[model samples]
Target: MSSTCYLSLDWPTAPAWVNYNSLQQLSYFTTVFLAAPLALLTGLGMSPALSTRFRRISKLVSIQAARSLHFLVLVWFLVFLVVHVALVFTTDLQSNLNQMYAARGGDGWTGLWVFLASMAVVIGGWIAATPFTLRRLRALPHHEQITQHFCIQGWSGVTKWGGVSMRTILDLVKPRPEAKWVVFYSLGDGPDKWRYYDAHPIEQMSHRLTMLAYDMNGRPLSFGHGAPLRLRNEVQLGFKQVKWIEGIEFVADFSRIGGGHGGYNQDHEFFGYHQAL
Candidate 1:
């Protein structure tokens, strides 16, 4: 793919350049002298062993100028190659067509059409190459968000979070029609000997921003934040973001869960079970 990309950069060369006029003194000098030095410059420029010396050289010659010259050499080589290939094809169309088309004896137009079709496929592939390999922000069933968090404790702050969307989890679990809530359990226990836990409605769980976060501000969640994992339901208050989460239980209702409340705070402090904004 890299080779094809390098070659295709010079694909728009005019057909008329295939004639004897292109092999002038300048072209000959470039093919012999410039080609060898350009090759050496590219090698030394990329070499870790030579990097310090190369930097000193770069101060005098400028690495950008060397790179430009190397690229020009590549372009010249590609154009020269194309010209020779075109010359071969055009010099004896019938014979070359026979050789190219598996020695299948036929009219010259048949081989010409075949060549044109191959060129179309090559050009189309070149155009689509970048998009096929390009990736954005290293995401795979992941999202990054910067939002504010406010809790009943009167604490408020903003943070950037990175995690997998709850919607992705829903697609994997495929909850039954009766499962109305998702209960998240934490490894941390409260003073009352109950584990810190919370519940979210099935609809809220499917929200795009509702996620299981393992990253905070481009790094793994710190202990002060939630190490390992935490829940992030954007539409709700910060208390619902269960920290040090251990397990998840899908249920029809939260009545059977701890303290018959939807969350640890709701059970202990009489806070409302649902707080959405």
Candidate 2:
């Protein structure tokens, strides 16, 4: 995916200036050079109390600048990678890869690589614990004291809802003590049905009702697809479901909303949440 992403940027040639014409090169350099160095320096910077050298580097490079650069590079890389993957699916995908593994045809190296990459993705689930993930999840918290009205934007503004706290919602439908996983379902009327599931014991589940904090199927989920969070189920019909979610509850009856018709907004009515068939 990285190789394809770099290719999709269409960098026929490297430019002399920093802000080159190719966004691909910028992504590559930023990831390999700028962002990587900054990450290392950040860890060093954290030890300021112990190492003056670390303190000096952190002070000199301005935390904001380092952080901004890191995020920009990451976003660029992911965007390019997604495009590249789509193109691979479009082009001679098998031939393109077979060319590299021509010598080891049918060997286990390719399979091994796939397995390793999968492991890397699973291990990356740790990103949920980061401070950034927390902020996005906590964007909207459910408050019993306050009249909870969905304030998020959706189709025709009919679906009025915002994020609810993972803890708050989970508390409502307390899971079994042995419950191994929490599932979040987002069923849109369109082709946006999504499901986000997170295993327990790991802090991968964030407090955000919409923001999920985990990778999906050995790859990180991108934005619009509930990025920085793991999408469990298929996209469901409802804008309210688009937001972050941590857990899911299957209630046979939703009499308060509608008897035995407990689903999303679009499921019950022809709301703008779902597309016209």
Candidate 3:
């Protein structure tokens, strides 16, 4: 099949050797056009940063549903791979292997050898990556414990969060007398990364419930649950509770940072600056 066929919804007539019927043609089209795009959309919806910032979209897709769809997408890709490989071997194995592995038309063992070596490199990289990933996660910082009420979406829970109070930390920094907002920054990178910061009224920092937590439920917070640090602001919606916190800054206003909407969510998704709900 030509590369252009992949871009269009038009179904290409199957080669006579493969003998694909209408049902198979429909399946191929759906997998390439519908399934692939759906997978990408669901994957984006599952992002904590995106879901939290874009609450309306999150409500439509839901994080749990996004996660489920992502898994189904994986299954679809696996099934497609199996069918694709079977067809390649059945129709003309040497030609397919040569085109993909050696970028030429040939019936030589060179293409097969190249394919095997590529697989080996992939497997070796995966094997070498595990320990480094573990070490990075283990290096996350730790803090003191404080028990408080935590709320997200429609769920509420009381948990012991280990961290220093925001008030206590602010005292150490000696923020400027005129500063009226506190901004929290998190660890994230790249274009898809959330702007990674939120600004709140300075007075909120002194509330007894405001804290920067490193542990939750009497244990070190896992990476999946925001390891290094997470904010706890009892009065705001959970999105205001920034995770993977890296720095804190006192500012008179947040109109100059990011898109100037007060916080990442506010700028990207147009969420309310002060989300008490």
Candidate 4:
């Protein structure tokens, strides 16, 4: 199938069993050759090691772009599978089953049983998967309450956030003098999804309002609101305030990090690098 797509072979018109137009042939060719390779390349762009090692390519195909393209590829595959199966069943169910499972030209129950079992496994796995798990907060050296939540979409909320200041953690870590940026990584959509993260200039971390918040509204944060820890950067828009924070790193430059465009939203959504508004 892949070889035929790569060679750009002409669609077969003489076969009586195979009934497809030029449009269908073009769609199949595009899905196999173009979408499949693009999906693979975008998936590779999301890898932390690969993105760092191949900085230029990573920048060109930002992590968020890779995620979006990957989703589109999945949609295409699902559409193709549905159409292909419908066509086979409508045309000749017995012959199709025999060719696929029995590997012969005779009708038999062997193929039907095999298909049923494969579907059962897939459905069982889907049912077994669950949602996010709760994470607990650990002891911190200092905690303070601040009321400043700047939303980027023209609304703002003033909630008291309780947690340790970024400066205090920096003091403990003792980052190198040359470090000019701070990167915060957080949990996203699901366990299978890529980690959500953002980068801020080192100067922004010095602001008194910046901290790793663990409590909101005088209560421990719920899992939906980023339990354990979340970044609170008063100077930037709310999106830059990464939630469900897992780790923090001090780096001299962000060019080697994911997408190399200052932050995830900036790289993918074309948001301003310094969103003070």
Candidate 5:
């Protein structure tokens, strides 16, 4: 295989190896090693003959093996595509390659260094965000509490909640000095498309008994009882403790929020926004 490339500034003679140079070698690698192999394996897997008499070919070329190879080829090529694109766009991409991209161009290391720094920041963020938080919320300090939930309907129940303390979340977000309240928005909505959200004091948020629960009675919360996440404020009525929480926002006040009231049900159903058990 022979090929040619402009890796260096010098335009070498022949640019060939065994009748090829940098470019020829590159073409050979792409066609023979990457594209051609994938195409050949794909064609082989798609043929109906593989499941017939060919199934007993030394156990290496069985129907299962063929299909596995085909699937692996797809995953392999996808990874290759992502890596090559990242290297090109993040490191050495140049609109005018004829005058740039060489080490002698005086900017060869700049893009690579910047790319490394960016990757470091991104990796740091991924680690900090995913391992301790994100959709996986169990990594925070767990606080279990048995409390009574009082509803305006005069019904009540004592339940055990397993969740992270609100203080942990407060430390993570570090709300601004002006942020007096945090609003919890629910996935549920009222008629006329009124979004269901409620505000609570920031001080109550940091209270030891307040939490965002994902487990009830030592089991993962079920959909009937607010799966994934739900607010737990032992000091407040049930409505004030939002369920099926979708998002949260920090604000200075709630008077300018929906219906000039502090919550959705309060706005629509005339319920008290700030009620206690």
Candidate 6:
């Protein structure tokens, strides 16, 4: 008599472990193990029973030192995040996502749903980071005055525009019924070079006009790089719109500032204000 048995086995090679540099591996391990455990220990250190032992440890690595180490690790994590993002863009993003999902042995329907969910998280996170969304959430509070320089304004060519939501900014200002004008004052480093456009009435202005917080390439605008806010007015030429705004005010006339020419536009400059398409 003879007996026959069949067996199936999966090996680690089936998953093909990706190689990581020492720093990369250490970063991943610390995030997964040491960091979490340290946090738990920090919390436990507050407990009365563990007070003696905790104090002993604390004396060895004093409280201030521990805090500094924790902060340093946090900064390290941020650096890791940058490297991770670079790798994601460098590699095939879809393939990586697919491989991760495939490891779960999910049915077709489940895999599809997971893919959709993952996409949603990425898109949702991007949207949440946008200036428009962030402003709505009060992440960038409307200040009475800010001295942002005009870093970049959209041009017909070779010009950059920060993605600023003009509609929301107008709403924040809430100009009076009698005040029909929107006056933008350039109060930054280049106040002398300030240009202004005879913008349309807030109500009449189309949504196309907005304060950009990001560039056309989807990159965030930094403070010095003309970020946090930008104005776009269809009624005025692109250059007339200011970037890195310092102050926004509602006034009856642009001439109130000086030289009855309304603004730099009224006084012919190199970039004359014209209605943009």
By lDDT, the best candidate is: 4
- Please give, for residues 15-119, the per-residue lDDT of candidate 2 as tens digits: 232243465576668668876676666544333121222334544664345556666656766876787565444444444334343433332356445545766
Q: Considering only N, C-alpha and C atoms within 3 Å, which residue pairs clash in candidate 1?
A: none
Q: For candidate 1, what is the TM-score?
A: 0.48
Ranking of models by lDDT: 4, 3, 1, 5, 6, 2
Candidate 2, after superposition: displacement of residue 122 in Å?
3.2
RMSD of 5: 16.1
The per-prediction CA RMSD against the true structure, in angstroms, equals: 18.4, 18.8, 11.1, 11.7, 16.1, 18.3
Instruction: List pairs with backbone clashes in candidate 4.
Output: none
Could you give candidate 3's per-residue lDDT for residues 233-276 as a string of tens digits?
87777777888765567778767666678777777788455645
Please say which candidate is ahead in lDDT: 2 or 3. Answer: 3
Candidate 4 lDDT tens digits, 1-277: 3436424643222235456556578878988898899888987866554554475775577667887888998899888898678756765676677677667655676776777788999899886763222232245555676575656577877788888888877776788999998988765522323345788888888888888888888898888788877888888877788887756778898886666787767667765577554
- lDDT string for model 6 (86-157, tens) is 554345444454556655432234444666798899999997765434455235432221222333353244
Model 3 lDDT vs. the true structure?
0.70
Which candidate number maximizes TM-score? 5
lDDT of 5 by residue, 104-127 (tens): 344346555655677799899988
Off by over 4 Å in 4: 1-138, 189-193, 275-277
Task: Count clashing residue pairs in model 1.
Answer: 0
lDDT tens string, model 1, 192-259?
A: 54456788888998777788888899998887687787889988877678887756778888775666
lDDT of each: 0.68, 0.40, 0.70, 0.72, 0.67, 0.49
- For residue 223, what is the lDDT in candidate 3? 83
